[model samples]
Target: MTELTDRYVWAAVRTVPEPQRSDLEPEIRELIEETVEAHLASGEEPSAAERAALVQLGDPERLAADYADRSLTLIGPRYYLAWMRLLKTLLATVVPIVTAVVFLAQFLGQGEVGAAIGGAVATALSVTVHVGFWTTLVFAILERAGATDAGLEWTPEGLPALPDHSRHGRLPDLVASLVFLGVLAGAVLWQQVRSVVRADDGSVIPLLDPALWSFWLPWFLALIVLEAGFAVRLYLRDWSWAAAVVNLCLALAFAVPAVLLWSEGRLLNPAFLDAVGWDPAAATGGGWTVASIITAVVVLIAAWDVVDGFLKARRASAPVPRHPVLVDH
Candidate 1:
């Protein structure tokens, strides 16, 4: 049996750049040597004929090109991928906590610390699901674009080429981000509690003080911001969870009843208004008027949010693979 030595592939691979030639040369040499040794085991010898034959197996230039691809990594693709993962983790952690706090406050009067933590975990999972789906779609497109005839390119310094693209969050998402929502909900509850506590003191405080109206108008704006944040998340492809819950709540609380009653043709009856504390027949209309107005508002808001979100998501990005390093191979 004859043995092949480094006399060698090293001399051949030395023609390439240090990055590819350094690491890859050794591996390629090892691979070829292994193949030759296996061939020798089948009664062939490490002769010049075999060497020339192996040279024809793959061109040196092509082998070097393949090695360069292995050395090169796309900074942007890798980074966005990792960044998206982190953002998902953060969203999953934050949004659900916000939802739970507000939900428990409405249903149980207040929220406990433990419940908030637990709910945060649930929210994190929810956020992960939405972000993961869109981000995966994005990377998949990137992968398709990055595939090459030479080979897959890659680099360790990834995704920093375009920091503007890094700002993946939408304005609506910012406004209605779970953190902002939770903060707004807490502020609202605090104000309500303060009002009640002060009222218990029997002070001569005006119930709907026109003076404090200016101060409270900010709260209204804050609520609008929270809703706006919700709108952004929807635009970013978050259709389930908050998006669904918000719309469903609006429909169940207003639209469905309004539509269903109207469908039955009994929602506007005089008896219906009177029972609900409205003088239907004596006035221009009845109880149905109140429900109808509220339902219209909810439906309008929901429709607006849905449409806006879709438009924004469509604008988030298109796939482009100009990165020199990083390939889908």
Candidate 2:
């Protein structure tokens, strides 16, 4: 081989695996020799023939990548669609939940709307960056590893059903409901053991009235679990009169005791209220205003949920229209 051919061979084999380098070098050299000989047969000089051969083989690093089956792009065509599908799925599902959680935590913790919005937006941006970076890293690893399949095999079962107004849209709502219930349960349990508020002596003060833990809190937790199960059943079985009735009962079970407790001034922690200077007796910017607003929101949400459940049930149970057959006379 000429000087150019020698350098070309070295560049091609340098980055390839150690075990492959020995075998690849000879293979590449032989191919280059054959190409050079062909160019000589075609009447080219030795130097020109070698240069032509090297140019035909193109970039040695790219040639090495081809031989090693390594992807040239960050995410190659093989896994590009799958990566995109997963990224979109995660962003759609996770970003909103993260934003909502951050916003609620900030607003509830600090009572500052601007701070809550800013925190939520910042955290969401951070989460998006992290998710994108990690997902790309994983796909890059998989591509380098020469994985033939990325677990995104399509099947008949994956095909969505014919679009229906009620059932098709139910999935996202059900998923959201389940997630919210889970978070609610976690927050309830969290307050029992830890709190952002502390007393004068630095003792933790739970936001909720801890004395109710013996009965009301437990009842609320149980109702939440039942509500989750009901939500699942509603998703699976569509909806029926029985399901709607159960939903109404669950709604009442949650709202009634909650409102009653709030009205009786036994819902929130006295210490927490005192610490925050939120006098329950005050008419505004205080416990009374907050409690009344909360009570109204609770009742309104429950009523809307129950009514929505029945409406969906009615829609799901509606009969489909049949096409009339044409008669041939």
Index of the highest-lDDT prediction: 2
TM-score of each: 0.23, 0.48
Instruction: Write down the worst ten-residue block by lDDT for model 2.
Output: 320-329
Prediction-by-prediction clash tally: 26, 0
Evaluate residue 267 in candidate 2 and report its C-alpha lDDT on the 0 to 100 scale.
89
In candidate 2, how many Å is residue 266 off? 0.7
* Residue-level lDDT tens digits of model 2 in 1-329: 66788889899999887888998998888888998899999999898988888888789999888888877898888888889988998999899999999989988998855566678889999999988999999999987887778368666787645555555567987899899999999999888678888877878899999999989999999999998998888777878777888888998889999989998999898878888877654544222355565677788998999999788667556565463121110
Model 1, C-alpha of 301: deviation from truth (Å): 0.8
Model 2 clashes, total count: 0
Which segments of candidate 1 are over 4 A away from where they belong? 1-165, 168-184, 187-290, 321-329
lDDT scores in order: 0.50, 0.83
The worst-scoring run of ten residues by lDDT in candidate 1 lies at 279-288
